[model samples]
Target chain A: MTSPSNSSREAIAHIAFDDLVALLEAIFVKAGTAPGVAAILARNCASAERDGSKSHGLFRVPGYLSTLASGWVDGKAEPVVEDVAAAFVRVDARNGFAQPALAAGTPLLLEKVKACGIALLAVRQSHHFGALWPDVEPFARQGFVALSFVNSFACVVPIGGSKPVYGTNPIAFAAPRAGGDPIVFDQAASALANGDVRIAAREGRSLPPGSGVDRTGAPTTDPKAILDGGALLPFGGYKGAALAMMVEILAAALTGGQFSFEVDWSAHPGAETPKTGQLLIVIDPDAGAGRSFVDRVETLVGRIADAGQERLPGDRRYALRRRAAEIGIPIAPALLKELSALAGAPTD
Target chain B: MTSPSNSSREAIAHIAFDDLVALLEAIFVKAGTAPGVAAILARNCASAERDGSKSHGLFRVPGYLSTLASGWVDGKAEPVVEDVAAAFVRVDARNGFAQPALAAGTPLLLEKVKACGIALLAVRQSHHFGALWPDVEPFARQGFVALSFVNSFACVVPIGGSKPVYGTNPIAFAAPRAGGDPIVFDQAASALANGDVRIAAREGRSLPPGSGVDRTGAPTTDPKAILDGGALLPFGGYKGAALAMMVEILAAALTGGQFSFEVDWSAHPGAETPKTGQLLIVIDPDAGAGRSFVDRVETLVGRIADAGQERLPGDRRYALRRRAAEIGIPIAPALLKELSALAGAPTD
Candidate 1:
């Protein structure tokens, strides 16, 4: 048997993308999520795993199960889509996951974009615990330029502020190109993502300088300190802080969702998700001034390569995705066993 | 005479905002711009001066005149607006100033936004040499949220690249508030604005570390070197670079204008402006999910204050504008004389 282990020390298990999605779907359904929600989330999480977004992939399964078990998120809640205007679509997630809300509203959002050349999707009362690129990449694949913003629970401090008032808010953008995969990026305004800090704490690793401050408001590199009532700093200081604030406005305030600071989950123990809001803007490049949008994107990509920038934003993900297609997605044996147990499958 | 001299030594002359606009208008007309173009440019420049954006105010007059003299820009070119879709408007600036193009398209853009809940304006073949806040702030005052992006001449490098592939692309956002001035922020993707680097070079001052790299691609603090042949780093490493790239795509590729790296003014020695593109998106907050958009903004503002943030993004500009309104715009006697000479007025 040709084992797919790339590392020398540990033997790894390899599973096809579809199989992984099926397993995750079973796990979610077992955890009481609606079948539709499970399918959407399973695909999203499996795509992340295939693309090497480890932080948002299988690592998030335990959190999702815990939050679902805690009754903090209504996995069976059906999203209510509202056709607000010619270019606006609002979705009430009804405390469900943001992905399902987005999925439910996407058809209407696309119709609006088709009619108006651009459209806005505002999703409120949602829990967004996945990588944001998944929320936008499909639009790019459909030949639309998409930008999305999502605000999470408060874990980041404003500039010159001692208290946490902003989440590790993320901004994601996706645009199509002529010859290759879409250019996509999902970045958090914080110096380090909350998930990354948690991973570091779990691994007994230290964070980079300027990542966060301790509870006493003193800068520290210890990940545990940052997780223990401490707050993350915005990347690039004030500019990043401004982007974070903008995310709050666009996601929470505009969507009629709770602000990052307003997210109070004390009533539900084991809740790991932040019930917040998300905003997505989709634009049709055919309505733009450019003669050929994808051709122009190709030109830019060539220029960037000529400039000696070896990697574009989504290049790594595309590479990993291709590798995953060629050989099944690599997973550790322990993780695979855990996932099998969650799915009620026999583990070898 | 009760001169508005905030400084001890210099005898600063005080002029009302209207007077300053008139002076700038005269100067633009003397420099060969159409009366309409001059009017719009004058108000934009005057507003910058009133709001303490000195780099984009009178300090930009020489560059404008120089570019005009080089015959690199058409000062009198009329903007042509096209209503492309229900929510998309395009403007061909015909190599003229971007302000006039935006002015010409604003009516249709507003109409579309009102009807469609959101609208996009694309301006191509334009020169945007002024501050970006002016482009978005007015929309906020009109009960809309606005976001704008403009890419300039290439002066920033992509990460891991030695060549300059991106400009000091700036993104500006404006939103209405319930009880105060609009919340606005205009920030460049680079570590510092090109104007600030020029100012530092003029003052023989060193820049902060990580600002830019010298000619050989080594990090340096000398603004002169950065101006000479070096390139600026993005604000927050790869994140800022990604934004800069996105701006190029949105403002140039999407708008059918020249990319920053494609800007070639070598034949026009005195040319200073980048004949690029701009993109603006305006949304009607009343069409959003929120009950009251402005009230939501007020809530965020109050929370920010409570979070110990002593100042917001646009607070300083509002304070400066108020002071200017009360005491008139203060200008150095020498600079005032220069402006008067350019306007063909008698200098005392």
Candidate 2:
């Protein structure tokens, strides 16, 4: 595949989607992940790349490999699922990667949701490191309404407080449509994602207003100050902060996982991946609303689209996904070279 | 009962909590409401006043009475609760006020949630005209985590569009604690609630930045422009807009109710309340985490509290409620006179 020029001055390359998947799979296997676990990890990476999430794509391989090499994440561990109640499922991730654990639990959740109108998955001992949409979208595709929450390492300060007590803590929701891709949305509670803040600082750029506060508890738009010791402000003042708190409780406390503040970042400062937790809820609209569900969703979505300038959620991601499949995934040249070395292949 | 001086320089009067309830009940009864329905409505109004929610308290009685008088609401209609699925309860609100509808459905929802760990109530043909916290907080007080969403008449523009496509679309979440009032939050998706905008316009006060846009779709902070011919913007930009869309789907599409845009506001313009729908979900943490649920919530809340200068969600409201109980409710002199006339009492 030929590289398409973007505006950035960085050297670029393009790899066919299949080739990229194989490369990531080989690298994860080389880093000592079990073949099945490596396959799931590679698929998640490929999807991120396919959806234009470069920060979580090939770029995260190095961090994942580091955690694998240090034996912080058990590459061979199998997640255990338990039906704790009539409608509640508990998944013990066995300190393994989140993607595979969720993969194991989702089918069970779908079955329960069919029997009951709603079902919940409480996943603990999981290491999550990618977009949450991938974890929720499949259920929507199968005609279920899905919502998910995940808590990570603490990186955000509560509104009106000086210290960090909550994570960026993302939430994702998806609903099925009649003849189109599901309506999906994923957002971190913070005004800016940590990855975006890091990229801005690396490029010496200022952030948007209301992004973060400095160590002295004063609001600042300087990306560097925010990254050094400051804290990212939650989006929409106290409202977004409350949503963050909701995520912490649902993903951690309710799931029997460690609270964000209880995580020992000091012990693994530059080392292991964080052990986190996630909660996924799935409901079958057909159970109650019947066949009218998809038409109703389409009605609401059509109204948004007919309004001219308004775009439906996930419209951009689905468009990018199609382009990625057609023209391949764009990658920075330096990262491609690193991937080739990890894959034991010659750089083009 | 006496008036208290506020910086707004408006005339104020205080009324005993019991008196306010009795007066509201009498007014609703005189406006052709069923005696039982009027009692529930009065209780809701009293609770709102006691909690310092002036916008939803006695202030809303006039709108409710107008709807009742115009026969837009069925004062004698009884809500029918159906267990449509294993864990879903569908409430036919019968085009009546939402308070009695929720009152009829809540017991069934509570029973199902205890048995199945989680349950949902989908209310259709409802007229929801007040704060959402009261609807959800009752479940939280009984050791359940509850969430609710309701769609009203469209008054908010989606992000990136000028015309209104969504309602204020309030969402409320509440989680129980061991020894205190539950942690609760209720917020409208709009940057400024319609009621707040009206108050600001009435007082000729400027709004906070990024609150709304003028008729031509230009951003403005003038409360008059926002209320007169413009639309309120969603809070937190596109992220908040997505949440508003979620509410529309859940409340209208899933519940078989009218979407905000589909409602013919012109049909009843000044006389009737909008026909809306609401979705309520309640989860019993004890079903999954057992006795540790309250402890976990307290731990997280305590950590936030330990970080000095931070306030927990609902703290202010709880404090105001305590004060309201101690010193009675403060009302404007004009509102008092109107209430006296409605209640057939002699005016001072």
Candidate 3:
């Protein structure tokens, strides 16, 4: 199925899940990534599509290639996990993609969590260009509560400040359920995520009030002004700013990686692999509190649902994932052509 | 110094730090609390006053005594700390006051955190009548990052719903700084704390827009509408609601205590000791990372300060504490008289 574009751009095309993953794998393999790393990266990109996050799907392949071409990211680098303590795992990502690094260390970290009741995975020198949920949702599926934080290149201003001092630091959390799916949520500390505002600016649409500031720090609803020189405001004034600081400390300081202010962002937009840090925490609910934990969670969830407040965190993503699995993932025809060219294949 | 009331109300009184603590202790003892529990409870009350949180200070004493009088709380109950896991301490409060329960468990939790890199202190069946910061600040002072969440009587509506389905759940966090006071903050998930809105309604003052809704589920700025029949709105819309759910799960579900909706709030104003749950997490930064943690935190804090955002999370509390310690705490004359009567003493 395809929808013609109003502009001269190519129409959208629907692609099967396996086909999308295979195409992405070919692209990264051609771009000098090891076959295994390419497979992991492809799965991460395909999952973003499956979960309806088009911004992080195959559209981002060009940016990943840009970072790989510039040597800012080591395509074949392997992550190393060291047990710094009984309940801590330090993962040096070796300047590679964060998804693969986390994929490598999660099982090891979960083992420690089961043994110690709680565990922390401190990931350093990784480039996290994907959504935060993918890194933490796996543990929740395996009957554990997981929370993660990551610090990116500086884009958001601190409260009562004009300049960008912190990244649009995001936090993700997931809690396991007894029989149903786990509850999971991921949110940036800013009023809107950077990519979202950029999409608004690209579509020539203005933003809601309090979204960001103009170059002179005057509040503006123009998304272009924010994307250009201004900074995104924190989500809930001082409260969200405090959370951003918490993310900075937990993801950067505790992970022993570069802080947001320490990053040197480019004048022009090109994904040079912001060498960032992330921290993930996992707790075995069975170990921490036993069977009573899941029962209690189900009780609260039932109350929330019975009250007709069923749109809990991560509900939208879950719905979209089911829809995408039944149907196929939608990608623009121009994007498919670009991927095919990158993989050295003719257009379908 | 006191301000004369327009209605011929009693003027305020200034009580010395030690005198305030002694007065509270006598009242708790008269209310049938054990000597040691009374001492701990009194210090908790005095510290609230010392930090200028007058709402939680002597103002809450009547509620505590009422709970004790009603036999809803076991005034002399001693908390038992059980080593639930390698990194978890489960404190059964024996249906007693939370301050004493926390007092009994803090050292044990801190020791586990120092050894395990992170530890969780779960308090169950405790009446947490005071502020949450006090429960976490001690560990921060001892060079640990502490976070605490407590679920209270239901007063706040979940986002998109008109009824009170959740507590004005408060979460507190503190991160230690080298040679400086810890950065600390405590915030209620509701748009405003329940007591704060009640004080406003008592004073016949209007509230900010979007604070709460009237009985019919229509948004209203009238404080009385909210205090009487309406429900407080969650802070920052759905984000605050998610945080509230996080607190409910962490403090209640994980701690094996009652959720907010499960509480039967009293019809009268006096507190009947809502047996709630609280979760405290402490992490030794030195154990997690190294010396680099402090330096990185300072770097980020300095940037925040340089941007004129120096009024960090805990600065106001720290300032109030220094001033109160040097001078004395201010109390309303009416409240002091009431407290004196409860303690079987004449006015000072």
lDDT by residue for model 3 (B1-348), tens: 223333445554567788888989999999899999999989988999889777788778878888888777888998998887778788889889888888888888877887888888888888888988888788778778888999987777776676777888988988877647888888888888778788898898999887898877678899999977788888777888888888888888888778988876464344556687888877777755644677778888898877657588878878988876666676677777777888899666
- Write down the lDDT that model 1 would get: 0.93
Regions more than 4 Å wrong, model 2: A1-12, A345-348, B1-14, B332-334, B345-348
Poorly placed runs, candidate 1 (over 4 Å)? A1-9, B1-9
Candidate 2 local lDDT, A168-273, one digit each (tens): 8999999999869999999999999888998999998899998998887688899888877888999998889999999988888888877778777454534446
Q: How many collisions between residues are there in candidate 2?
A: 0
- lDDT (CA) per prediction: 0.93, 0.84, 0.81
Question: On TM-score, who's better, 1 or 3?
Answer: 1
Return the lDDT, model 2, position A290.
Answer: 33
User: Who wins the DockQ comparison?
Assistant: 1
Runs of candidate 3 with Cα error greater than 4 angstroms are: A1-12, A266-269, B1-13, B265-270, B346-348
Top candidate on TM-score is 1
Better of 1 and 3 by DockQ: 1
Residues forming the 10-long window of minimal summed lDDT in candidate 2 chain B: B1-10
Error of 2 at A328 (Å): 1.9
Candidate 1, residues A41-100, lDDT tens digits: the string is 999999999999999999899999999999999999999999999999999999999999
Tell me the tens digit of each residue's lDDT in model 2 across B22-137: 98888988888899999988988888888888889877887887777776778888998888777788888888888788899988888888888888888888888878899988
